[model samples]
Target: MAEHGWLFWALTSAVFAALTAIFAKVGLQGIDSDFATFIRTLVIVAALALFLSYSGKWQNPATLSVKNWGFLVLSGLATGASWLAYFKALQLGDASKVAPVDKFSLVLVALMAVIFLKERPSAQEWLGIVFVASGVLLLALRR
Candidate 1:
């Protein structure tokens, strides 16, 4: 059960992601997307801080190695950029369209994992990635 824990968490993340798009779209009305993203980031930070404290999971930042800090900072920057772009898209486009197009990251991640991480996905996984890429193309191309 513990080995399959990731599957449960991944599904939960998907549900939250779907809700995030819907809620962000509605909240973005009459607001600057960058400002909205900042507000969202603040809420996330506060929530995580509280959760970490309550769960006794808070760790001393100074204990982390340089490599851990560097990669985490890079990941944070990437996440911030992604959220800003996603919020801007949601503000300008239909949520239904913007969300699916944003999910194109799935295909990009798989390809990047193969190239950079040297992780070879099984053929079945590659097939799914190809289908996801095709679907993203279908969503992105002008009809």
Candidate 2:
């Protein structure tokens, strides 16, 4: 079960991601994208805080090393940028088209992992990336 944990979480992530696109698209209909992103972020922060507080896993901030803080801060910044862009895209484009294009990040992540993390993906993984790329194009192309 532990070995398949990531697969389970990835599947869960995909489901929630679909819901995110749908909800954000509808919520963004009349609001500024940046403000929408801000509201979403606040809700996420509150939810996580509540979860951590209930779980008793809210660690002391001073326990983190500088390296850990640096990476987490960078990750947070990237997430914020991605959310802002995604919300703006949803505001301007069809959710169906924008979401598939956004998911091209999946292919990019595989490549980036190879380059930056030196992780070797199997041939099957590469094939899956190819299919994902193809699907994105199919979904996003106007003609």
Candidate 3:
């Protein structure tokens, strides 16, 4: 919130989440889940490379430190692990149930930001969280 530019990222992320659910459903229809994830990584790496090139930010390495590299590697590992677990979860459980459980990461992140960055959600953010949580829960509810 300090940087209003993050608003765009937040909006984009919401779209990405919905798209991910729909596309993952279609992807699971025929593709091997692990193979699908591996292929997606290539797409992501290519997209990132393209973004860096287009932004003309590829030349700059000074801003990144060893810790940044460590974090990036860790993040990639986490992503791969989560993808496997998620796809398997979807195969076993209802997507609506699995999705809301997954969305708890949002709450975890908010708490982590408060602890690590001393950042607090504003009133609007809390309201957004309420709506997000409610939607997820409603989705999870059995008819």
Candidate 4:
């Protein structure tokens, strides 16, 4: 378990992400997706702030390097945008369909890592990506 700690965390992330789609879809009813995203972001910030302060880890954030800030800000923006689109899609589509399409980003991430991060995926990883891509396409096709 210690050696595969990351795998455990990744699996936990997938479970929570699946729950997120179901919960968000239900919550989006009678609410604007953008407003819902804003509310969710506020909740996340509050939770993180409370955890950081409780753990006495809330050091001066100003000490972070400019490069760190730049990347973090960009990442936050990307997250917000992704959430917005996901919420909107969930509002308009079935969770079963929307979730697979959204998760197709996993395949995109693998390709982007190879091209931009110069990280080469093993053949098995590539095969898994292909399977995910195929599943996404099948899920997306009109019945």
Candidate 5:
């Protein structure tokens, strides 16, 4: 099971992401999306803090390499921007439509990995990416 941990976690993430769209759509009612995103961020930060503390995984940030800090900071910025945009989109659009479009990130990530990480996806994997991209286009361009 441990060897297949990534599969399990990836499925779990998808479940939670589905829930996130539903919950965020409802929660956005009568509130500014930016404030809602801030509240969500605070909750996530507190929950992760507690989880790390309970799991004894807390580490000194000062000990990390500069490269680690740099990339982590960049990743955090990207995540913040993504969350802000997602929340706003959910506020304005149908969650069913918005979430699928947001998942176009899957195709973007595969392309980025190939370009920046020099990752070589097998033909089968490329086919999957193409399918996902096509699906996203279908959802996004539909009337």
Candidate 6:
């Protein structure tokens, strides 16, 4: 691991992502999904700008390679789409249930990466994914 420890960043991101769902669930209580997404994005944009200013690391990209531009735009759109749908889900169900179902996308991505990307996982990783799927399934049986 690097001196800063990538695991710390990963865990921080995970916790923030979970809390984002909770906040969106509460904040979007009476708003339409589209409007909620707009509100969230605007606020996030302002926050990002402020943080960049404070950190003195803001940069203007005057040139981008075609491939890099394509990847960046596609990734940004995919992320926005996910946030939109996730907030909608959070709005409609219990936070615990909605969060688990949304998180199942992780398992879905793992499977899809194997099938489409030809990515392989270790035996233990496969077992852990299977457990994740089973637990998610069991959640549906709860009253």
Two-way lDDT contest, 4 vs 5, winner = 5
The C-alpha RMSD of each candidate to the native structure, in angstroms, is: 1.0, 0.9, 3.1, 1.1, 0.9, 2.1
lDDT of each: 0.94, 0.96, 0.80, 0.95, 0.97, 0.86
Off by over 4 Å in 6: 1-4, 115-118
Compared with the true structure, what per-residue lDDT tens digits does model 6 show for residues 11-114? 99889988988788789877897799998899999999999999998876757688988999998999899988887877778888877777788799999999
- Writing each residue's lDDT as its tens digit, candidate 4 over 1-143 gives 79999998999999999999999999999999999999999999999999998999887878999998999999999999999999999999999999999999999999999998999999999999999999999998857
Those runs of model 4 whose alpha carbons end farther than 4 Å from true positions after fitting are none
Q: Candidate 3, residue 109: CA error in Å?
A: 0.8
2 against 4, candidate with superior TM-score = 2
Q: Which scores greater on TM-score, model 4 or model 5?
A: 5
Q: Give the winner by TM-score.
A: 5
TM-score of each: 0.96, 0.96, 0.75, 0.95, 0.97, 0.86
Error of 5 at 18 (Å): 0.8
Off by over 4 Å in 2: none
- In terms of TM-score, how similar is model 2 to the real structure? 0.96
- Judge candidate 2 at residue 93 and give its lDDT: 95
Kindly list the per-residue Cα lDDT of model 3 for residues 1-143, writing each as its tens digit. Answer: 57899999989997898777667767777767777777777898999999998998786667789999899899989888998887766666767687787887787788789898999899999888778777777877757
TM-score of 3: 0.75
Question: How do the residues 31-126 of candidate 1 rate in per-residue lDDT, one tens digit apiece?
Answer: 999999999999999999999989999898999999999999999999999999999999999888898899999989998999999999999999
Tell me the tens digit of each residue's lDDT in model 2 across 1-143: 99999999999999999999999999998889999999999999999999999999899999999999999999999999999999999999999999999999999999999999999999999999999999999999976
Clashes of 3: 0
RMSD of 5: 0.9
